[model samples]
Target: MLEEDANAGYRRLFDDDGLTFGAGFPLTGTNRSTPPIEEELRLASHAESVGFDGLWARDVPTYWPKFGDAGQTFDPWVWLSQVAAHTDEVALGTASIVLTLRHPIHVAKSAASIDRLSDGRLVLGVASGDRDPEFPAFDVDRNERGQQFRERFEAIQALWREEYPELEGEWGRLEGDLDIVPKPTAETIPMLPTGQARQSREWIAEHGDGWLFYHLPERTLEDYVADWRDDAGEKPYAMAIRVDLADDPTAEPEPMHLGYRAGVEWYRDYFRRLEEYGVDHVIVGLESEDPEEALSRFGDEIIEV
Candidate 1:
């Protein structure tokens, strides 16, 4: 298979020798059940002003109380479009949209629209549904999510790259009699699959434009990057880390959920290590009393170093 080159968003965010950073939405450390959405645009612009490369939005179609996280509390498409209007250079991304829950056609259309609106700065991270109750709520069979995920993935690709391409599978069929309009700014928008999405590593390596995974320890990250390189060649590798920045610049590393509670000095060294291990980009879920201060600190202290 011929691999597509990185889109503008990917190129801006990933380089051969260094790592780039992006901030996750709901930049404030607000309650999980009710994110402070009013702060998003201001912080998004602030992130760009401070030299962050991208801003990511989470796609939670429906909030499950049991899940305990509201994930930005807005539709990914609408949120990204709004973000795009307020910022010029920063890449806009979906941390991972639940592809299994949405129709592929809708995903394709919305993705393309965002790509055009943002002038090709959209990076789509997609995943199979992770919330169990969501499947029943959406009237989709949870058991077939793997198959549905594969089908939707292929369908979106076909819709983007082919002119009236013939496609047939679980999601439905495109018989080449019709076509989806407003193609992406590039040949296609970048699509990074999150955490295997029930597919084999081989499959993800073969199909995904890149790979997005949760935070792992240094040794595990090295192994994961090695395996990805062996199977996928030079595709980008990205991950998310939950960070609680301490006031002291030289604070020691401490464990947190999927990341660490550390200070700028530790974070700088940590990111340097990630760059050495071939991580291309990182999405940071920042924890701070004042998100603006945190974003400014990260850009000035860690990213500029």
Candidate 2:
């Protein structure tokens, strides 16, 4: 499908001029099994109301202690449905669903249903299983995640784009006699392969509707974008940034795992550089004592500027 065939969610991020931001999941900043669902929904509403472009959810089937992130402490489909019901205009997305651990038919149905429910506002970010424990929990082979991801992704695409596609894979087989119901609001849901997902860079560019990645250094990101252009041209490239904004608006960047602890001015200049590198969207995570206040500052100072 051409770029224009993408749903509203995809277009909101990629069809625009420069970069837009998405609020990351677990707004409460807890990795516990239970987070404040009502409050999180409240925060999610607050986020979109303040002009954040999208609401992102994560799919963590089972929380692994080693992973230390429960990813919103709810299912992506469920939480996003709640987000969709409460908000409008802003896109709804899965930071990623672990496809290797799910059947393609199920994923397709859930995606289509949510897409339809959200008024064509579902962007499905999919990934190979990575939490190690999840593979065994689902009786999946850890080593074969890459293959499973590729296969499931292909199956999902066919399921959406075709009426009765005949296919066979470890995930399942279709005889062309049955069909998955609730087709997407659009021709197909935009599928972004996240974190390499154990697939080659070439494969992702060739097959993915878009690409999702973790934070990279500025120089590294420049090289990555250069390579992405080689095959995918202007197809969107998105990433996650864990931010710890300093009180001083002029403080330079200080390193933190996948992002930075920097002043607002530094972030604005950084976003400009990212735009120059052809990075289309960023999933911004604010790590602060008061997430709501941080988001307020981000919307008023960082995103608005």
Candidate 3:
């Protein structure tokens, strides 16, 4: 069976027969700054009610002027745990968690706890991180991001899948005497590496349960899907796109950063093409004045139609 078929969280977000969609958090679509969250919990519940398959949270350890934005202005674990409480059934994803800044011990424990709390609904997206200032702030050498990312990933897997597994790495030692509590509801939680993750494509194909990538043009996406199929077979592939939806359903698509400002008619076509090209899931970050209405419009016009 495919990984998506095997893992509950993975299955929630991906299916072999057709594509699925997820709502990116900070669902209000505020960029380059923190957005208010008075309605976030309600919106999360609303998203699930409207047929979204997943809800994604981002990992932003600290705010930096250079950083694009504060991701939901909350820690991913706390936010997802809260989201898991208010909503059920939607896959709870980390858009990703920066491995270099966190110890795998913590990640493993948190993931296991959350998976058990949410009943195997956690799908982890791990990344090497791209912010320059965060490196020095965390006292980690920028040069060692890739190595740390790999080591932490392995450590987390060991903790998740094995009992008292022996391991020694830059993080610390697990000397075959101690164990992390709260293993996932499944055999192990799903781990999807985001972006290149400072690792080779072959490495990701070998280790990742799935891959989370940025938006790409249709021509590029087709080639990406083809390459992914060749390397990873049917392992699920998911991508993120920022959308500025228009009021008029018949309006044509106009290019925007990492996505399009298009009407619902064009929206339908784009999603169909994505599915045809073998993309498994699309994480849509909606940019709009009234995000709640946009969410309804997207669900009514694109997903339900």
lDDT of 2 by residue, 152-180 (tens): 99999999989988999998799999999
Runs in model 2 lying further than 4 Å from the true structure? none
In candidate 1, stretches whose alpha carbon ends up further than 4 angstroms from where it belongs are 1-5, 31-34
Clashes of each: 0, 0, 0
Per-residue lDDT over 1-305 for candidate 3, one digit per residue giving the tens place of the 0 to 100 score: 26533456777877448788999999876645766666888899999999899999999898886766888888889888899999889999998999999989999999888888897889998899988999999999989988999999988998988999999999899789999998888878888999999998888988899889999889988998889888998888999999888888888999988999988899899899998888899999998888789899889888888
lDDT of 1 by residue, 42-103 (tens): 89899999988989998998878888888888898998999999999788989899999999
Q: Report the Cα lDDT for residue 208, model 3.
A: 90
Q: Between 1 and 3, whose TM-score is larger? A: 3
Best by TM-score: 2
Would you list the C-alpha lDDT of every candidate in the order shown? 0.88, 0.89, 0.88
- Candidate 1, poorest ten consecutive residues by summed lDDT: 1-10
TM-score of each: 0.96, 0.97, 0.96
Cα RMSD of all models vs. native, in order, equals 1.7, 1.2, 1.4
Better of 2 and 3 by TM-score: 2
